[model samples]
Target: MNNLNYGIIGNCQSAALISEKGSIDWCCLPIFDSASVFAKLLDDKKGGSLSFKLTDDYRISQEYLWQTNILSTTYDNGVDAFQVIDFMPRYQQKDGSYYTPPDIIRFIRLLKGKPQFSIQYDPRLEYGSSKVFTTIEEEYIYSQTKDGKYDSLFLYSDLNYEDIVNQKTITLTSNAYLLVSYHEKLSQQSIDRCYLKFQRTKTYWMDWSEKTTSYPIYQNEIIRSALTLKVLSYEKSGAVLAAATTSLPETIGEVRNWDYRFCWIRDASMVIKVIADLGHPLSARKFLQFVIDTIPDKDEKIQIMYGINGERDLTESFLDHLDGYKNSKPVRIGNAAYIQKQNDIYGILMEVIYRQFVEFETTLENREELWTIIKGITKIVEEH
Candidate 1:
């Protein structure tokens, strides 16, 4: 049985699910709403995954690094031991902007003796409907659909490329790194650069966690939940996702499944309220900006949800090629609830806006904008 015993690693731009055994079973690159590059969680056969196959005697365990989104999976067999550290690059740049690319780094470091494993780098582009062809180059391994919407991925690794592609068992003598990216990197690529990125990302997460309000009781739980909420927020648009995945049935072999990758206005506003109370006003401010940007015109009918990038018209559809999670069938993407007229959304949105006005000080112009939005919401509420 396929269980949800997976660790999530994301850069706020996109996220991936790593199994307890160190396999990237589900991931969508570049952004949360993009077509999946790895979807083995949905279909074990046609869906693809990047995994490390170890011997039977090895013991495996998965856990997130303390105070960071970095996930570490360690494998041990008494004589040999190693850890695969997985994370997506997310950090601040020199100009105060962020450097969050659509990339996942897997750092394999040897802990003791010589640990041997095989790499399975299978990527099914376009929901496994497109025919993908993988080619090797000196700097990176490229996988793309031979025919279709021009989807591709680049994998830069310090390990042997041939062995990785051939799935041959190799002994780990020292540290190795694999960088999977949605776009081609312009800068020079090396193991040292990979390690630097890992450190920077670790620092970013730690700093973010430190900024959250901690309680005397359940401090760890609060920080952990805050980190999870932070990861689900879209950095570019400040839209909070209800969930990252789509089409996992509520019950096995049932059709009660829907896509949840989009941002619901009511849901995001409520989350912002909690986050603001936790001393993270930055997220709340960003979400307010998202609300403003989404409803530029006061007459525009607000949707229940919108794309992370503020895209409307989120027409839902199904991918027939891939099997549903656990044979539930009817894998779906996008969402169809945007057309629904949920009157209570304005109330939730107004609550957050009201909190922002009372809790934080802002510029006169910004305050005026909020006041105007408040009037707009009041008018809409009266109309409904």
Candidate 2:
């Protein structure tokens, strides 16, 4: 379950990486780089995990649903088979806005025969230290942890349930759904309504793919990679992260893993070009806007990386409670590179600025002022 081939689902604000076994092992709330609510990817014992695995032993396979980020996991044991549909709530509203609530939706569909599943709803907050307390209701379950970082997380299921802390095995032969939310204790959308949103989510993603994905050769590879990038992007501000999980070491027993939750300017600038080449020019343009908004007129130097909302001071910190990936130790949160001197970013960003002129027909607003800023930055690079 700790391997790298886990499927990922996101809706701009946050992301969740679920293992092929249908366990949500790594997920950060509010945003991608925030403290992980489920950290089983780092430490299996103390790390938080929510399980939805089949009772019967079977072979499992997972893939995206027809050019979408929505994942479909199938389990088959010759006679009996079932599938788990996983996706975040995201679809275009009729008012030209998006209805992307902070919720994770899972639909269990009986494909061939009856399937039974074991349920484990354990949520450890503040990087797997603060255990979440639960209150089980007639139809829904409410859980609360410490106040500051991720206070309330709830799960509403259509299945008949009584206990929250300790739960027994549940069997399902028909369609069922579970909606887990981070912000609100109760979901604004009902459990049945979540089913409709799942359909619309598939439609919305496929429609986006149909419009944006157009490659003659190596089409599947290109589309899947593009979809991964799309899920990693923060839609509200157009910032893109390097990866989802933090402190995952390259080699076991080696503390080589660094936090990659922040959006680096040099990396994002290149990603914008790649996204544009893949046919989503709008996304590239939005990332450029994010870069422009990060320009600090007052500070003496520009930050190499920032939060999705243009936050600075990315002071790195270690989580002492949980051991590092594979016991590498020193599991870090924020990136310390923000305080270092990164000089090559000017040329990298200038390359993107040149791309803006070539790829986009954007009118150069305040040409003289723009040149003045560029010249200033170039001078700094030369001086260094």
Candidate 3:
């Protein structure tokens, strides 16, 4: 693909795709594991996106800085040039408090001469399954859902929506700068706090990245992958998403589509091992704690998946109106597989707990419970 001037802005939970032209084509909201709010990547009509493109023809190329998750995209409109720097601030845990935000930042700068840019802030909520309520503000466009659970779509730039199209256009002079931030409901104080928090987040990422130990090989790729993995993690619960998107089609046009917005016990185990292997024991421990906290005591039958914050009862449904990705078929939401009885889950959980004990030099306080379950399993096996 010819390098398109586009980059990604993420909140370490969810992310948005920003073209060098200043358009947001993709963004999943509430959490990284949530369904797409702007899914133009899947279906253009049903899948909504925020797009910024130049009225004039532009050439673009994109790349990430070495060993860093920061994305840089360059745009050339023949005579003029500009660049966009995109990154999500990493959260930090210190003094028993975590510093982070559910925000995405886009920093735009003019590299040469002047360029005209157009911005479009169109958000399709619930995997493009729901229309968003748009409120045009003086400096930003506030898009919220009716239920008001997920607050999204704040565009910061010198642009105005034209003719109710939910788009804006701006002219950039040399050395001009623009910062666009997206977040959920935030008070005036919180918004100010978040702007400051953004700086601290940048520092945290840069510092943490500097302290990263060397890997044997593929160091740069490893760092990028590690960051991507971290970005997918739910800091509040330590659960990681399988991917940022759901129903993207593992195989386009196949029925193999599955909702991946929830935490999979299987993936959790793998994540623990990966983090441990990477010498981050604290992350693994937090993940274990999250699992322990989420698992119910009444039922020995462990669920195969849970919401990012350990929510249960995710009902599966289809958006029949919106066409599927590449017209694959029914676009599904929620997850039906949770109700299925997977016998191996118990075994997997037990194995993971056992491995954690060994690797972390810790003891299992619930050994009796585990032993009882194991004994029951053994009795059943013998009877069979």
Candidate 4:
């Protein structure tokens, strides 16, 4: 059975879902709404993935590192064992700004005797629509689309590039690192730099978790849930995504699938409220700012949803090539529901706005703008 047993890792700008066996089945690069770099979760055949191939005797186990979004998957076969630590770098830079890159790092460590594995580094560019051409360079392995719309990715690693591309078995003697990036790096990629990033990212998440107000009951669950909401938040635009994927059927053999990588006013407003209640005011405030930025004109008609960067138009379309999840057909991208008018959104936004006003003080300019927004919502509500 194809199960949704995947742990997520992200730096807020983009996220990827790695299966329990350490396969990155779904990922979109550079941004949440970009065409997928790895998407085996949608189509088993056409959609590509990056995974570690282990022998039948190997026993696999997966878990998130405590208080952090980093995922650890271990493979053991009695005599030999190793772990694959997956994480996307996200930490605060020296200038008090966040350094959240669209990069996924896989750190491989030998736990016991010489463990063996093979790297399956296939990547389908532009939602599996284009043929990808990979070239190994001294600095990194670059893969780009050969035809159609232009897209690319880079893989930097200490492992043998020929062995990785040819699927040759590699005996793990020591720790190694694989870094996947959407953009080419100017600085030299090395194992020591990877370790530093991992440590910084780990510290970032732990500190973030520590800041979230914990209840005596369900404290662990609350932290996990809060962490999930945090990762869904886009740092650049302050938009919170409804979900990271598109075209996954709600039920078997149904067409209810829709792209949720965008932000819905109703959904985001509610999320802001929940986040505020959890004592994460920054996220809540940022989302409010996103709302203001999205609808600059007071009289403008509100969209049901908008892109992560506050894009108004969300034109829905199909990726007919993809087989969809579990043979479900007509895989879709974008969301047509953006055009649909929801009457309750005004009230929802009002609630969030009211909560923000009550709990926090704002500058006079912001307060005036928010009051103007309130008046606008009131007028719209009364009109309809």
Candidate 5:
């Protein structure tokens, strides 16, 4: 579960890393910046995970849907087999706005044989510290943290939960979909709406792929990299995260892991260039505006990075409760490099300004205001 065998899925609002072994090993609930609700990627025992797996022996294989970010994972043994199609629903709708929801869709189908499946629905909240209370109603298993921002979680499915409280396998005779969702707002979506959203999401990703300019021969690789950037871009803030995950040691037994969840001006300057070039100038536009808005009034030190919400004080700290990934010590979070004296931040940001003003040739609504801020940044960079 701790290898590159996992696939990343997100709706820009939140993201999860699911192991091909049928476990949702890493997920930052509610939002990408929030503490993980299921963090088995960091701490196997203390970090929580939810798994929907076939009960018997099985071999697993996984791949993303052609030209899209939707992941399809298949598990089969000689005796029986099944396939679980996993995705986070994200798409543009009639209003030209996205329908990205914080939900994990597991579309399970009995592929070749009668593969009895089991579910382990253990969720650790508040980074596995707060007490979680779970309740079952009809076909839903809902869990709520004591005082966390995540009010409650709902798992809506078509499977029978008559004897599910104690963790057991239920034989499957038909296909079904399981949705592990966040917040009460999405919980109100009917089972019919859930199915409809799934179809729409599949079409949405495919449509996006179809729209992308196909390359010569590396078409698949190009689409994948482009789609990954799209997933990491937070639509709400116009800020793109470095990565969806945090605290997985780069080198085993070395404390080199760092949280890459925030938007770095240095990073976004280039990220916006690709996103804009690929026909999504809205993100580049938004990120450029965000960078301008975040510039201080010639007094405060312009940080190298900021939270998606524009928070400045990113104090680094270490969590001691759980074992690190592969026992890599001193699992850390809240990158302290924001205070670094890296001059590249200024250079990269200037590159973005060049694209926005020169390459795009688009009229800026706040041209004077933005120019003043740019001049201010120049002054600071010159002196410091």
Candidate 6:
């Protein structure tokens, strides 16, 4: 029987899929909100992925490390064995601010006997809708797109790809190891700088994971979910997406294709409650602050289903050229809801403010200005 297993490693902004045989099936980078670079999970041929597999038969099993987003998958080929570790570093508190790359890392280690493996690293640009240019440096494989609109990916692996047209194979003896990394577009110097950053990033994640408070049951799963939620949050704007992928059907071949690249007010409020219940009150407060900073006029006439860094303009459009997931039609980007009128925003905003004051012990320092705006909104509501 061929035993196959899978696990997930996420930075809370984005996530990756690691198979038991040491393959990375999916990953999106820079931020959870960014377009996918490796999207083979949606389309095997067109969508790209990073894959590592053995030439011979192997049995596989996978699981996440305790209370962390780190994942481990083991491959046993009768007498031989090996494992792959995958993780995305978490944000760190250094110099009173968080620092870490929005990248994914995978490490493969040999355990017992010799094993031959083939490594395939393919990256598609712009949600698998564009071609990518691949470059091979001394220790890294760089894949970049033309327009420079999306995040580039850097792969660091021992497997050489001098002639990428031809598939390459490598042999690993017991105790041997290989590391692969992904990052955004960077110059040669910038790539060189990442080596040091790799060490720092690993330490940062390990340290942060150490700080998490323990739970009695389902601790690992809960922490992974929490981290996933956290990564989906826009630290600068406090907006959170429902998910990373845009066209993944809630039901295959259905019209459930909705773009999740921007912040949703509904999801943000729900996240506030989730984070608060998880004992991360600061995160909830930050989201509230983001909401307050985002609303400019407070007139209640300027509300939307979603926005980008508080920008009221999100012009929705469709991409007719590229086929949708599972052949689902009409792949669309952006949101046109900003143009619509939602009378409920005024009451929702008032309720949010009230909830913040009561649950978070928040008091608006500019109460006079806030009340003046409230009076205007009340007048509008009364008149309507």
Task: Report the lDDT tens digits of candidate 1 across residue range 11-65.
Answer: 9999999988999999998899899999998999988999999889999988889
* lDDT tens digits, residue span 1-384, model 5: 346677888887888898878689888877888877798988888888888645447788888878777788888887677778788998887899988878898888778777876788888877776678888875488788876455567777777654354577777677777788775553454557766877888888778777777668987888898888888988787888998887877788888889898988888778888777777766777887676667646565777899887879889888788688888877677899888876777777777776777766545664655677678778887887
- Compared with the true structure, the alpha-carbon lDDT of candidate 4 equals 0.90
User: Local error of candidate 5 at 168, Å?
Assistant: 1.4
User: lDDT ranking from best to worst?
Assistant: 4, 1, 5, 2, 3, 6
> Candidate 6 regions off by >4 Å?
1-8, 17-25, 146-151, 161-166, 174-221, 300-304, 337-352, 358-384
lDDT of each: 0.90, 0.77, 0.63, 0.90, 0.78, 0.63
227-287, model 4: which lDDT tens digit per residue? Answer: 8888898999999999988888888678888789999888888888888887788787788
lDDT of 3 by residue, 124-161 (tens): 77666555888767555666677635555665444334
Q: Please give, for residues 1-384, the per-residue lDDT of candidate 2 as tens digits.
A: 255678999987788988888888888876777677789888888888887655556888888888999988888877777788999978898898887877788887788877666678887777876767788865567777755555777788777656325666676667887777776554354556878988898988888787675778988888888888888889888899888878888787787778888788888877777887777888876777776667636235778888888889888878887787678777888888888777767777787666666766554663333455577677787778
RMSD of 3: 4.4
Model 2 CA lDDT for position 165: 50
TM-score, per-candidate, Cα-based: 0.97, 0.92, 0.80, 0.98, 0.92, 0.78
Q: Model 5 TM-score?
A: 0.92
* Deviating ranges (above 4 Å) for candidate 4: none
Error of 5 at 30 (Å): 0.9
Candidate 6 lDDT, tens digit per residue, 44-124? 677777776565578877876555566777878887777766766555665776654566655566788876666676888
Off by over 4 Å in 3: 1-9, 17-23, 33-35, 55-57, 93-96, 130-133, 144-153, 158-169, 174-199, 210-213, 341-351, 361-384
The TM-score that candidate 4 achieves is: 0.98
